[model samples]
Target: MEIKNNRLTGATFVEANAYNKTAVMKPDAIIIHYTAGASGNATVKLFAAKTSKTSAHFVVSEDGTITQMVDLNRKAYHAGTSSYNGRSSYNNFSIGIEISNPGYLQKIDGKYYTWWEVKKDKKTATPEDKVYVGKHRNAVTTMTYWYKYTDEQIKAVKELCQAICKAYDIKEILGHEEIAPGRKCDPGPAFPLDALRADIVSNTKKDLNVSELFKDAVKESASTSLTIGRVKVKLNFRQSPSSNAPLKSSPMAADTYVYIIGSDSTGEWYNILYEMTGWMDKEFVEQDNTDDNYDGELTTNSAMLYNDQKKSRRLVSDLKAGTKFNILDQQENMFRIQAVVEGWASSKYITKI
Candidate 1:
């Protein structure tokens, strides 16, 4: 598909022999999993093989590179016998992303099954080189296994979640264990579920109102302006909502600073600092600070001009002082004005009084 936005990417059609051709799919949920293989390449190869009887829509490597395996429109075999929110057969209607990791733990067998011991020989069983085995086992099964995912793997998964939430009208995200609680547990305790969910929910919620959320997120993520004379001064360090919180007070100047993030409808305050998000106070900032020198001479360099048509060249001799002009906008060297008087005195002669 054309990848209309940041939604899911098109599948690369790997190891798809087991996919149900008759299954109709419309993704409403996201299923996360871990490929308990030794390496990402090996995991990809395994899923790509036609005989594996299992496939995910995408496989994210430890380094955050994503490999697509199945088309978003078609069914992938990853979610076997899974259900969520009263819906069954999730494979027919969900995107599955298998993260590459060794899983919860690793297993190593010392002295490769001494042949003499296996044969019950009285002589001491000669030891052989230790053989490593994958320890991750099915929770429901009797076998014991261990595999550990790397930090990079977890970060990659979170980013992938953000991307997926951005693209689809996804209502909920799930771990494989959540979908098949009795059978699966690939994404173990190491996977930060709360943090991932927070990102997904935050991104998905923001996409519903790109402009508003962007503005709000921007305001919330950064400090707001305070009028000091005609200039809008920014706080040296953004403030937060609480008095005791490290972010609540500015370490720079102790002036009255407003937190931009906290002005949401909920009445909470937050401020953006270095692009990082934090809570702050709404009372400290004003949206339309009237004292912003609206009474000053409507000049071309007042910092409010926003268009190109008004900044055209004009001679300095054509502007008149008492002729009066409303400051529509002000920019670098030009001022956009709506003429209040018809007579022209001089062009470039216009100066802010």
Candidate 2:
């Protein structure tokens, strides 16, 4: 994962001819994105086309193959009219890396589908490979089936960002969604965007490695029973499970039901998430009540079970017409039911026993 001559990204450049001949760019940041297209080669070719009007410096595939399209020393027309830190039009000050991903997937029928209306198997689409299911900040769509960044892709991006930082004196790393906010949402939460910058750009480690990633998943996930926590008081939410890991911008306020990622090595810290990953002292965090009283039965066999309120949350396992479940919670038009399978469904599609 070395950059040579600001052109060859680890001995590969996909001949990116569709770029502006601007004066040399003294890059200060890296903006990450997802192609939302089919594959790496297709995305590379699309950016190479002069009419595409969008291009990235590099495109990393799902399997971690790096294809340098635009030279790192030049500005790639990736982020349009994006601003950050007083710099408007982010393309001028950043190198863009578009990873090949489907972004958020829409599950349909007994199968899962990409935004392009391409169908894939449920098992293949949302495998527990370096991915986590969660909600996003300031976005209507909860990540029912998040497109995960592969382990190989994660490592490659880490090395590539480190190289770019050193090559161009890059000072910051950001996502397309961050720079453009309401207008864009690439490289979403599931991709570990923060963890990438923490590990490579800022030299910190919010390590979501194999051993610790799923260590407490069964015990902490919605599968076992959602473990909701409340902060006793204000607590420092550091990046990694360490007291010294660099506090995230936000804090765990008193009595907030935080989303739990996992626990620390010492079990003294509860790796939690409000918007992003951070650690708070476990002692101050208390497991709040998770009991609910309603019991119900499905009135119809065709009723759809979803991961969330969004009916796009199609679950593979279906409950028979007379199946029973315990209602954990209820929102405006959806009911969170469990026992048979933990998920949400339209209240109209189910009935209480």
How many clashes does each candidate structure show, in the order listed?
A: 35, 0
Question: What tens digits encode model 1's per-residue C-alpha lDDT throughout 5-76?
Answer: 323454343544556566566666678887866567777888777677888877877766677766666688
lDDT of 2 by residue, 237-348 (tens): 8878777888886676787666565788898999775645578889888876332233676677546556677645555234455545567789999888753235677788
Predicted structure 2: lDDT:
0.66
lDDT of each: 0.50, 0.66
lDDT of 1 at 56: 84
CA deviation > 4 Å runs, candidate 1: 5-15, 21-24, 106-146, 208-353
Error of 2 at 195 (Å): 1.2
Sequence-dependent TM-score of model 1: 0.45
> Mind sharing the TM-score for model 2?
0.54
In candidate 2, how many Å is residue 119 off?
10
What are the C-alpha RMSDs, in order, of all predicted structures?
Answer: 29.0, 13.1
Top candidate, metric lDDT: 2
Q: How many collisions between residues are there in candidate 2?
A: 0
Angstrom error at residue 315, model 1: 89
TM-scores, each model vs. reference: 0.45, 0.54
Considering every candidate listed, which one attains the maximal TM-score? Answer: 2
